[model samples]
Target: MKEIFEYRALLIELVKRDIKKKYRRSILGILWSMLNPFFTMLIIAMVFSSFFKFAIKNFPVYLLTGQLIFNFYSEATNTAMGSILENASLIKKVYVPKHIFPIARVLSSGVNFILSLPGLVLVILITKAPVKFPIVFSFVPVLYVLFFCFGVGLLLASITVYFRDMFHLYGVLLTAISYLTPLFYPKEIVPEKYMFLIKLNPMVYFVDLFRDMVYYGKMPTLDEHLNCIFIIIISLFVGVVVFNMNKKKFILHI
Candidate 1:
């Protein structure tokens, strides 16, 4: 980790490059970061709320909270999966730690996620969703989710170096995960028999944590806090182990 701090300038440059490259050709530029989630929430609320008739109050805020958390995970992991391959030329020419590439990708996505928070606040104000003082500390779960994503991003970045096919497979897997998470629908709508599957998904707990603080305006339960911490620890352990094991061989494969 000291090595990463030593290369902090490089990481910062990489993150800035990523954020710039994402918006380079666009007219709105960084504003799109805020607009994308805002529009997504609007479209989702229109389609699901009107067609499905969810019973939840302030459904747009509910959907936005879940979407923000899940979208960060999806964007971070997907971008991180390609981080190694995308920076192949640099890796070949440099001796920098390969782990930085995925970490940089996750940080860049996190910037975008943070940029989109104002959209959530807008939805909250527009819908008049209950807001409380405790919601100010919502960053606690957000930080956990970020660490969880960084760990998963590391694992994906390492694996994709050897098995390029994993990229395509992950897209399909993410789609399935999106549905399995209660992003667009209410958890109560889920059938009793399938509730176990939802409980087993780590993303469910993360999303629930965000919803509890932001949407429900309450602190996450003790179990919810433990679940987030447990997943963060386990994922980081697996990610670092897999990444270290595979990084030396990356040059050969790439």
Candidate 2:
């Protein structure tokens, strides 16, 4: 804890730099973070509502819930894919915990997610969707999501340092997992025989929990909550093990 505190400034600095670089030179600047996801959700909602004719009301809100959660995973892993490579010079010049790079990447995404919250509120208010009791209890799942992101970021950051190919592979994996996890559709749409497979992906639970709290206006089952915890624990375990074992090679490799 003392060590983490000592490096807190470095973490903050990296996160700041990420947020700035993310919007640098763009005409909209920081507003892009807010607009990007919102517009993307709009397009998706339109497609599902018009072309596919999914009879869901307030589809934007439903889509936004998934977008918000999936965006965290996407942004964190996407940034993490090249974290060490991008900062090779800095890593070589200074002695800091290599883990900080991935943590900083995840923090930047967290900042964007927080900024998007107002839009979420506006949507809920405009749509007049009933906020659920689970909203009061949603903090628990959010914590699990953060831990899962941290763990995955750590693992990806370490691997990307050595295996440059992982960057490309991860992009494809992210796309595949996005559709596979029911981000655009409900679990009920899937055949009953395959329902069990969908639940195994872990992300499904997070998305379901978010939807339940925000859109469905209900609490998810205890099993759904436990699934997220399991994912967080296992992913963090792998991440810490791989990161500690290989972080020593980061400076040399990068």
Name the top TM-score candidate: 1
For candidate 1, list the clashing residue pairs, or say none. none
TM per candidate comes to 0.97, 0.93
List per-prediction Cα lDDT, in the order shown. Answer: 0.92, 0.81
User: How big is the RMSD of model 1?
Assistant: 1.0
lDDT of 1 by residue, 190-226 (tens): 9999999898889999999888888888887788899
lDDT tens string, model 2, 1-254?
A: 46558899999999999999988889988777777887888788777856434556677787788888888878887897678788888888878877888888988988887787777777788778788687877556666677888889989988988888998899898887888787667666789888777867778888888778878889788887777888899999999899899988777788
Q: After superposing candidate 1, which stretches have Cα over 4 Å from the reference?
A: 51-54
RMSD of each: 1.0, 1.8
Report the poorest 10 consecutive residues by lDDT, candidate 2.
Answer: 49-58
Pick the lDDT winner: 1
